[model samples]
Target: MKFTRRASANWKGTGMEGTGTVSTQSTVLNQTQYSFKTRFADGVGTNPEELIGAAHAGCFTMQFSFLLNEAGFTADNIDTEAKVNFEDGSIVSINLDLTATIPNISDEQFQTIAAAAKEKCPISRLFKTEITLTAKLA
Candidate 1:
């Protein structure tokens, strides 16, 4: 791979009571706090699922934009949200919600492009689980 992004985590103590901080090479999440509370409860920090959701959303949106460009369409706006559903200590599914504003595009075309983007996004491909998408054109 030509691109290599990196992140690291540090923890002190047991999983339940332990506190940890995650850092990325870009320092966007420099020593960001994460713990059991953050992952499974109402804690004031980031969680793994949340990060996964963000990555999926970012990747999917970019892929959608590129697909649109290839289809000879330019979107005025493209909004996407990814919800990673964690169950039984595994990621069972993911739901991608998208709203886009593009000119001169039919619903059939939009749906095809949306589905393509969802499937082609690297994060979506990385997960071995059901992925659903809801795309709205405006």
Candidate 2:
């Protein structure tokens, strides 16, 4: 399937002093505030890295669920944290920490499925940086 999504940003003034607002087509983030301080320093609001991490975490977790179902297992709980490591104005790597509770699944099976899901997830595939994952089954 082919589809599209949209988000917009507006900024005023210089890069270091300017502030911007980002909004999604769905209005979930209706002109959410973002500023230089928010991105590079401590400030209230959101940053691009956190947004990307959240998106990656959400996408990978959902893809994992789909894989578990296909493998004849269902997860009772799945939690994932995507850590984006940035350096020298680039995202160097992403680490996905995942914990899942599934019924009647072997450790080997879980590991295999998690690895496959990590590779198959759309967000994971989008990144050229190294992606590492640590998955635990509980």
Candidate 3:
């Protein structure tokens, strides 16, 4: 199956002095500039790349929880953080750190399930960059 999202951007002037528009609509748009990405904290909003990282992290954590449940284990908490590294304007890697509280599971079993989740998550398969996962069981 295939899925796609439509996005468009329009930039005016130079990279430092210019601003842009991002839209799903044909005409009306949202404004953006270099400050939108670098100088500003993204709590207001962000571009697709940042949004993708957020989606990947959250989706993977939820997927891991489901996998654990299928193995007869339940998790108290699963916190995942994903770091996206850009080198020379290219996406270099995505690092995922997952902290989970799983009651009554052996360390070995936890490792096995964690590995399964990392490899089996759909988002992991969608990316070409390196994906690193650190799973801590507490």
Candidate 4:
């Protein structure tokens, strides 16, 4: 019922000229900076926010797929994009955009299932921030 991951980071110089290494016991991320123009793809390492977004999106989509199946529907593909914004040393908002290609479902039913998935998803339960989800069925 509990899971955890350990990651480490090291920074040199100031925000602009500084670079850092972020590593986990399994993954080593080096030469990454959260300053200037450096970000998820800006360096050789990945940032925490980016990783969080990826985790949230991936988790939500998989949860949605399972929930839909339980609701007598199936998804051909479920893609989610998550955005997390930070401000004043806190996460401001978490936005999720989900596009699903589902079969044998009406819009109302899809919305119902998607709403249940959003509420029941493990990642959705983990964060205590404002989370917005836009679900599109195609």
Candidate 5:
């Protein structure tokens, strides 16, 4: 049970003025553009932190769904948002905001499963920074 993914980046010129394109194995983002402005300022291109957030959110939601099914419940909908905070060129923390709708499930049960998912998800374990989760049943 092992899997690996790959992404590559090519940059030119100085940090402030350089530009680059990032490509992933899935090609969901094929040679996507990114630059200093995109990373440090409000630019038109995607950044690493944004991509990380997307990955984290996707992973957590899927893991939560698995947990719910194992608990004999099915989730009607699960929405998760991951906020990756980068400060001083380092990742400081990640905040996961989750809202879910599951029939016949108590808030306590839902919270318990969500907390377990947050602790056991693969992406959650990859981060060394503090990971916080806020889960709500809808």
Candidate 6:
């Protein structure tokens, strides 16, 4: 199976002073504001790195849940945070912190599943930089 998602960004003005709006086909982000201030400085809009973090966090959590279920365990709750580092005008690394609550699952099994999910997630595979996962059972 194949699927495609699309997003568009429109920018105007100079780089330092320019402003842009990002729109996605899903409409979850419609005309979302982003600018140099948002990316390089503290501003009132979202940035590309933040978006990538969100995607990674969501993808990893979902993949972990699937793995848990396949291993005969059901996750009662799963929370993940992806911190993406963007430095020197390039993406450096992404660190994922995950906490999950599942019944009847050993710590070793959970760790194995979490590591597999982190390694095999589509979003994780997209980046060439280092990706780290810290998982804990809650």
**True lDDT of residue 52, candidate 5:** 96
Error of 3 at 116 (Å): 1.2
Give per-residue CA lDDT, model 5, range 38-119, as digits (tens): 9988988889999999999999999999999999999999999999999988999999999988999999999999999999
| Local distance difference test, each candidate | 0.95, 0.96, 0.76, 0.80, 0.95, 0.94
Q: Best candidate per lDDT, number?
A: 2
TM-score for predicted model 3 compared with the true structure: 0.73
lDDT of 3 by residue, 1-138 (tens): 797757676777776655565665433334543334442334444555665687789888888998899999999888999888777767789898888899999988988888888788888889999999888888
lDDT of 4 by residue, 1-138 (tens): 798977677877887677776666675443344543456246555667887898899899889989888888778888899999888778888999988888778989988888888899998899999999898888
Error of 6 at 120 (Å): 1.1
Model 3: how far residue 4 lies from native, Å: 6.7
Give the poorly placed runs of model 1, Cα more than 4 Å off: none
* Model 2 C-alpha lDDT per residue in residues 1-138, reported as the tens digit of each score: 999999999999999999999999999999999999999889998989999999999999999999999989999999999999989999999999999999899999999999999999999999999999999998
**Per-residue lDDT of 1-138 in model 6, one digit per residue for the tens?**
799999999999999999999999999999999999999889998999999999999999999988888999999999999999988888999999999999999999999999999988999999999999999999
Return whichever of 2 and 3 wins on TM-score: 2
- What are the clash counts of all predictions, listed in order? 0, 0, 0, 0, 0, 0
TM-scores of all candidate predictions against the true structure = 0.97, 0.97, 0.73, 0.78, 0.97, 0.97
Rank all candidate structures by their lDDT, best first, as comma-separated numbers: 2, 1, 5, 6, 4, 3
Q: Stretches of candidate 2 above 4 Å error?
A: none
TM-score attained by model 5: 0.97
Q: Which residue pairs collide in model 5, if any?
A: none
Candidate 3's error at 22, in angstroms? Answer: 6.0
